[model samples]
Target: MLFDKIARPAMYRLAYHDPEVVHERTVRLLGRVAPALGPVSRVYRTDDPVTVLGLRFPNRVGLAAGMDKNGLALKAWPALGFGFVEVGTVTRHAQPGNPKPRLFSLPGSDGVINRMGFNNDGAEALARRLAAHGKPGVPLGISIGKSKVTPLDEAVEDYRFSLRALHPYADYFAINVSSPNTPGLRALQDKAALAELLAELGRTSAELGGSTPLLVKVAPDLTEEALAELVEVCLGHGVAGIIATNTTLSREGIAPADAHLAAEIGGLSGRPLAARSLEVVKFVHECTEGKLPIIGVGGILGPDDARRMLDAGASLVQLYTGFALHGPGLVRRVSRGIAGRPC
Candidate 1:
């Protein structure tokens, strides 16, 4: 208990570097030791079971994508007691993400900003990892996006290629059109493009003859009108669920003094995202009239943030920044907070 109490803060301090650097170090170190994660690592593992999107979740809290971009820590992450893990915003072609200083921290505000721009090792490598890694006894969500240099015109094809490469490995797939770092990526979020892309992907997934769930991860920057249209598009195309927010470009509610790296060219996540994410979740819930499942994300620092999302209409929630700040204990805390609460 004493170790856990002191360790989270220190680990968080060490992690406040560039996202890509932190990411690479984590993969190298954990990848070396992950295989040694035996019974002792089960300290935070939870037994609570949840069924969402026709998939069984070991718990309700998940580690959102961008944390384990290559699916490198698949075996180890679940040991952290996360009910689910979303890895990658993988593209069809591997590319180095945005140049350094791509991640920044606002230590005072407990937030982070990153323009890492999807620096993944590509879909095929991730597919290989997924194929090689043992199952974590929980569902895994694989998020895919367009390559950095991919033109808007062929974005669908890029996604299609990635989908094909990653289909076998992902239990569920999240179409990520919301990341702010990628140029013209949000254009896919437009009604017509979204409809055409998703319809085709839906058909393709159907042809695979497996029960893979499909989710769309939306941006927090979207206005009510835009969100409503996206909701309509999702429902019409039979989207299985919506990850109610990626990061935001908004700096509202943040004092200039506290905005350590607010000007950083990336999406802002953590405390700054709490209010808008809840609002987006609520909008998606009411707009769908509760038919669609929304995975609440952004902020989600502690039980209160998790509870806010659930109460506002999230079926489940994912956290990256929060997990970094507070550590794996959050999964148990949030699960205990939500257990037997409601659907």
Candidate 2:
């Protein structure tokens, strides 16, 4: 209530000037104070432990990828009550992503449009930071993507490079091929291409003794047939689970007041994404007959959205835009709500 009433309103005003600036400053501040605040933050932690992909999570709610691309605020997430944190979309090479004005806020629709293009300090840098700071209390999943300069055909090796660099730091890996910002990135989701990529990563996982679980993130925009094929490819390569879905290219639910920003080319997330993401989660769960675990993400904004995803077959749910909009209190509220519910 405090956040929605006060902090959120202040953030909205700041967002009008430059959302990313406010975001960067906030993350840095949290990173600096996380250690001192750790003890107090634990009050929000829920005891509803659940295991997925052979790892135990303190709760079902997690901070999704893209929030901490370089893992700068690793320790802060657990302190803030997140069950897990998926960091990065880091690539083999560090590069400046799409130019400024790349991130936009659509307050009218309670959504965010970003074409960040996987900006990060690269896999090796994140690995070093994790090594220096130590892992957070909760499980940490590293999301790896192809470098923008890397061609589609070489995406296998590009992702392989990041996986190899960060393998020791990640409890699990989220292979990100669904981001709409990178040119030709989503094309890697095609059946044959996805198969080849997963096969190569599968080989690397085997070579590493297969300790870390692998999960593929899919786009909500995929056709039903395409989604089915992607699932088959993931299962074929011994993937541990799937994260459905990533931001959508479609602009179906933008509010009229925010219609002016609708044409911005990027993935749409938050409330606008709830229906499509839930639909994808249900479809994947039903298609796999519940054999495969799922980490549902996209438009989750509160406890109810989290419950719907779990009931739809997601073993866990992640928060991105919601966290940005509602502040840390949302994590506690959602965690407590889920903890109070029957499993």
Candidate 3:
């Protein structure tokens, strides 16, 4: 209540509504206070444990990739009751990413539009940070993407480099080929391209002792045919799971007051994304006949949204824009909701 009523509002107002500013400040604060967050663990943690991809999750809800891109506050996420924390969309090389004013907040519609690209300190930096910080209590998923400077054809090697750098620390690797912000990134989702990518990743994972689970994050804009083909490729290539539906390129559900922001270029995430994401999860589930595990994401803003994702055959779910807007209270609510405990 205090976070939604006061802190959230104040954070939104910071730096004249520059979303990245609030994001940076929040991550830094969480890192600083992580050591003293025992009370947070006690109050927010919900235990409805399950094992997926050979990794045990303390709950169904997890902090999604791109939220803590560099693993800055690794310790604080478990304290906040997330079943797991996925960090990075980090690439092989460090680059500044797009330009300033690249992230927009749509409060009225409960959405965010970002073309931030795959901005990060690179996988090597993240590997060092994880090493120094030690692993967090919850499972860690590292999302890797091709460097902006890397050509489309060479994407496999770029992603492979990061996987090698971070392999020892991650519980899983989410091959990020669907973020719309990076030019030519989503093209890698095509059947042939994805097949090549996953094949190389499989061999590389084998070289690294073959223990880390590899999953793919997909876009919400794919057609049913495209999605079906993608699933077939995943099944054929030995991919462990799929994170159904990353942010969407559509602007159909924005509020009237925020109509102008809808014209912004980038993937859209939040409430407007709920229906499409759910549909994709259901489609993937039915298409695979429940053989493949799915980490459902996008548009999960509350407990009901999380519940619906689970009902749609998602083995697990993750939070991004929802946690950004609602704070840790939302985590506790969704955790308790999934565990059948009263919130």
lDDT at 173, model 2: 97
lDDT of 1: 0.84
Model 1 has a clash total of 0
Q: Judge candidate 3 at residue 218 and give its lDDT.
A: 89
Relative to the true structure, how large is the alpha-carbon lDDT of every model?
A: 0.84, 0.91, 0.91
Cα lDDT for residue 41, candidate 2: 77
Q: Write one digit per residue (lDDT tens) for candidate 2, span 263-325.
A: 999999999999999999999999999989999998888889998998999989999999899
How far does residue 277 in candidate 2 sit from its true spot (Å)? 0.3
RMSD of each: 1.9, 1.1, 1.7
**Candidate 3 residues 1-343, lDDT tens each?**
7889999988888735588989988999999999999987999999998888998888889999988898899999999999999998899998888998888889898888989898899999999998887989889999999999999999999999999999999999999999998899999999999999999999999999999999999899999899999999999999999998899999989999789898889989999999999999999999999999999998998889988998998999999999999899999998888884221
Give every collision pair in model 2. none
By lDDT, the better pick of 2 and 3 is 3
- Name the regions of candidate 2 deviating beyond 4 angstroms: 340-343
